[model samples]
Target chain A: METRDALLEAGAALLREQPVGAVLTQVKAQPVAQRAGRTIGAFYHHWSSQEAYHRDLLAYVLDPQRLLSTAAAADTVLADLPRGLPLEEVVRRAARRNFEIVRANPYVPLILALWGKQAQDERVRELLRAHYRSVTDRLVPVYRTLFDAYGLTMRPPYTVEMFAATLTALVEGLTVRAAVEPEVVPLDLPHAGDLSAAPGAGAAGAAPWDLFSATVVGILRAMTMPADPA
Target chain B: METRDALLEAGAALLREQPVGAVLTQVKAQPVAQRAGRTIGAFYHHWSSQEAYHRDLLAYVLDPQRLLSTAAAADTVLADLPRGLPLEEVVRRAARRNFEIVRANPYVPLILALWGKQAQDERVRELLRAHYRSVTDRLVPVYRTLFDAYGLTMRPPYTVEMFAATLTALVEGLTVRAAVEPEVVPLDLPHAGDLSAAPGAGAAGAAPWDLFSATVVGILRAMTMPADPA
Candidate 1:
């Protein structure tokens, strides 16, 4: 690997463990160099100062393509699902997938730390803005595909933009809930079509729904109507 | 006010100005005492140590009553609106009120700071958990009232708990969006029921909807149906 790539990769690994407040303090020259199997001379060869290094590190961390890969992967997974699945089942799978992706993501804690820095740093805020826009861009197509696949269109006064933003925010918000109050937002969501645990759901049985899927399905049902055939 | 109250209030004021990473460093005994107009001895008399003081501060800062007051007020405002307004209008008002309340709230920044501390501090996590519970508890009744007042009930496969949690998360998520990407999540949401700016909305004209209210109103409409009279 190139010297800069090795050093940055090492720095990224170091940052993954640091607390929100210690992001800067954790990224020192010697340790990152040692971890990268590079020298201090190599570090300075690529960057002029710690500030410059930190700026590049932030960019590397917040790069839209890197940050949004999981979400993109989700779209591919959902699109490839069996064609006959019920819409609610499809939404359930999507929500559960979303919850799992966020829970398993290694970058979440670090991304959150960067979010904390946004209030004090203009550059961080700009990077975050670009990141959110890309997020919206990525989600818009996923939502559009679901609507098209199901022959649905948005209800009056609600647009694809609003739908995308809401889903993104809902996921972001629930992830925070999961972190601090796991009971409130359970991690083990029932499979999309499972209903055996639902109370009084009858002999076929209804699986008790979770907050994430329940909300997503509800939004999907409420926001769309059958597309016009004419 | 009592010396403890005085000190805590002062400390809160001080902490509000500090960035998320600097929360701990900003809360010093001398400065807090000076701000509270109390002697250093008085500060010690109230608290055994800085750690003890910080514990109390976290509790004070996370107090459900103070944090939830704005949400509770939104409920009162919604309930007090004229009895005969259209449901969409009513929902629009509620969404707009929620957006305004969160945008104008003084404690939001500090609360977010504390949230950043949760990964490292068990106490902060516990406090946040308690805070989220109180938030849910507080929101449940407000949602119930909205449902009852409108003679609406949740549609099949949905429940009040999911609604409350989604709304709370949506607000929290959108608030973060507003902070980082204000344009995408537009703070200047149109007034509820005003459709003057809506594209091709015709003679009555429709106002351009914002991300927050559109998602909210969509959820409200999607998740609810007319109550059965039987």
Candidate 2:
């Protein structure tokens, strides 16, 4: 159990700091006597194989309790947030922090190794799906909070879940993007309140942070307000 | 040049049908006799290797013209969208259309591939950054039309361009999600106007499309109007 826990801890560490590809390489390079290999060996001994170890590793990463707890913290802090900071601002701060967590546990891409190529194992698919559903479930509340706070009525069944899924997808995408292309990130993408078409050309005198803050506020306002031509 | 074009055309088609990893296997299976290998021969003869071929393939996929054209068309529709439907309703319709376009193209994932692994080549990184810039440019006008129509008073400097980039990022995220995890994709993730967070029960009774349209109207009404805290 200790060895297994050590393996999980090590993997989680590597997933956060480097790509999964690099993680596998680093693990293989360990001395024949190091605990890293034994850690994996223990996981396989208990779980069946390295592939199974990853399945459970991902499941652990997608644990809803951990995710929701972080969100709960964010929710608590929202009460203390400046009155007019806006939901987009809230999401951005939350999003960056959340993605940092994801970066550290970059098990998402490796899950594909088991889920995509190992489709023969129905159990793997079920495990992966369950993890995904947990993610979707955990995110729904974040969207629900934003919509409700803004006085937006979430459409039933899919409203909170849908927006939740969109954010999940975006976060997942960003994780993948960071893994693959770290350069073209939030700094480059449009903010929710982008009022102009010019990239990075906030107001003539507005500093970058101010421009970004305003953009966030603006998007929440736009989404909140009436967009009808009338 | 013609052979290069032919290889690229063939490669894109193959990429659309199968995963990037599967491409080489499928290509190699093709009559090497015709391709020394025919188009393969032609491709390698002009280009250094498959990696080079792929690099160009990515360049082609990120070409701003195509992305901008899509943005322009979306803008025309959004700008001239009827007022009868609530603003959220209109955005949802647009989001659905955007998903269909991405679903239709397999090479879209290549956009991420280029983004993830091209920093070694300064030219590739610049091209990708440029592509990111171009897409944002095209999306700004759409935000402007909506923000102006909706009468949202966003602070200056963080204008339509930022919104466009943000929206594009969301769309890109959706495409990647659908490719890797279709089953988990929230049915409503691609549909934007369904921002309502109503309870999950009794959702089946309502026509989701209609409910979504109404809900966006509701959200917009809510966002624009002051929260009564009633």
Clash numbers, per candidate? 11, 27
Put down candidate 1 lDDT per residue, B30-102, tens digits, no spaces: 6566545566786677677866766666676577866544474467546755566655556555666776677
Best by lDDT: 1
DockQ for the candidates, in order: 0.14, 0.07
lDDT, candidate 2, at B203: 35
Per-residue alpha-carbon lDDT of candidate 1 for residues A1-230, written as tens digits (9 for 90 to 100): 54323322332222222213445434656555554556677667766776676666666656776654447446754675556665666666667677677655545545555665576678888998888888888778777887888789976555677667777778878887878877766544443222322333322224445677767765665556678856
- Model 1: residue B69 alpha-carbon error in angstroms: 5.8
Worst 10 residues of 2 chain B by lDDT: B20-29
- What stretches of model 2 exceed 4 Å from their correct place? A1-96, A99-128, A139-159, A170-230, B1-41, B64-92, B113-124, B141-157, B176-230
Let me know the TM-score candidate 2 reaches against the reference structure: 0.53
**What shift in Å separates residue A106 of candidate 1 from its native position after superposition?**
3.9
Model 1 misplaced regions, further than 4 Å: A1-26, A34-48, A81-84, A186-209, B1-22, B37-45, B72-74, B186-209
Tell me the fnat of candidate 1. 0.24
Candidate 2: Cα lDDT at A207:
21
